[model samples]
Target: MLKKGQFKNAVKMNNIEKYFGHTAALKGVNFGVGANEVVGLVGDNGAGKSTLIKIITGVFPPTNGEIYIRDKKVSLRNYNVKQAYKLGIEAVYQDKSLGEKQDLWRNFFIGRQITDRLGFIKVREEKEIARKIMFDMIGFRGVGISAESKANKLSGGERQGIAIGRAMYFDADLIILDEPTSALSLKEVQKVLNFVRKIKESGKACIYISHILSDVYEISDKLIILDRGKVVATIKKSEVTLKKLSEFMLKYAHAK
Candidate 1:
């Protein structure tokens, strides 16, 4: 639960529009993620989900619209990954951003490394913290993995867990996940999904984007359906059955 004065919405995008030359990717997309809410973005391929996420993360600026972080309007003139990270917005994609050759601790702090006053890396501290984050925050129950284990050596689900844990460790207010369970075995998918529950339990919000409607139905508190670059409907999970949500998506799906 949020203490007395915390902002209600972690992020709010008003009339977000994205264009690729003559093509319109997102048309006036208005969305918000409240604290501790897990919102699922479900749509067929090419329904503008990626475009909207790109705009949110500063990979591409919206052609027109306003974005607010913690209820304060932010100008997009200098929007970039650095600014996004500074604002506590983190993303975990299916590609698993860890360096294959690097160990777990190194991958955990790949871009943002802890350093001493003289610029020497605090390797020991980083390893301990990484171990705790993976074992505790991500619920890695097996306990065989070590901080020295290479990223490539872990299973796909375990790597995804590490990435999510890194986001939590950094105190991200809203974590965007782009198909984090793609192409994984059933067991691996379950493991990755469990970590998302961990995120919700931590009182942080998440924007989960995926084509897997079943996984979305199992986890999301609310569901947003997009068709042809526009939001078709926003339904609370409690308000409808999974079969109904699937029907809605199917009914609105169209070829671009």
Candidate 2:
């Protein structure tokens, strides 16, 4: 059972709108993501998914309407990437936001870290944390690369593991993943899907934005279809058939 203020849904957008100069990107968009639930956001190339994510992450404020976290209405003004972290809202974009030359531990605690008494950086502590996070939080049990393996040296699947592990280590209540498995092989895609499922089992909400309907059906607990800056439907995973979801995505693509 979820408490009223606890926000089973970590994010709620009511009539969200975004305008760049004079062009409108989103118009009266509304959506919600529940706790421990994997909600799939499916649409064509320019269905306002990125805009919506930017709004939720405080990259930009909505031109109109309300945005809430844990049911508390909040202003997005002055809220930057760091603020988003404090709010327990983390976004893992398709571009893999890890430092290529930096090791896994360095990338994991790049922006945030624990320091020693004299304000010296604590490398050992960070590595320990990273190791624990990779194994416990993300269920990654692959090659025993020292925490010092460069991120670029990691394979596609391994890099993804590092990214997801970082997000989980931050104790993020809501994670927004944008095309996480877009560049991976079939086997690697399955590995990423397994990590997503683990995220839900750990009782955190995840918004998976993907163009792949099959992936969505395989891993999502709910589906939210967005078309031309508006939400077309929000359906339960059990209630939606793969054929129905594919049809919805196709219709949305054609409508755009």
Identify the leading candidate in terms of lDDT: 1
Q: For candidate 2, write residues 68-123 as lDDT tens digits.
A: 88777776676666777788999887545889999889999987878988987899
Measured with C-alpha atoms, the lDDT of residue 178 in candidate 2 is 87
C-alpha RMSD of candidate 1:
1.6
Per-candidate TM-score against the hidden true structure: 0.96, 0.93
**Per-residue lDDT tens digits of candidate 1, residues 1-256?**
7677588898899998888998998998888888889999988888899888888888879999999987789889998888988998999986559899889899999888999999999999999999899887787776568888998888889898888998999999989999888878899999988988999999999999988899998999999888878988888999999888888888876756
Q: Which candidate number maximizes TM-score?
A: 1
Report clashes for each candidate as comma-separated counts: 0, 1
Which residue pairs clash in candidate 1? Answer: none
The lDDT of each candidate is 0.88, 0.83
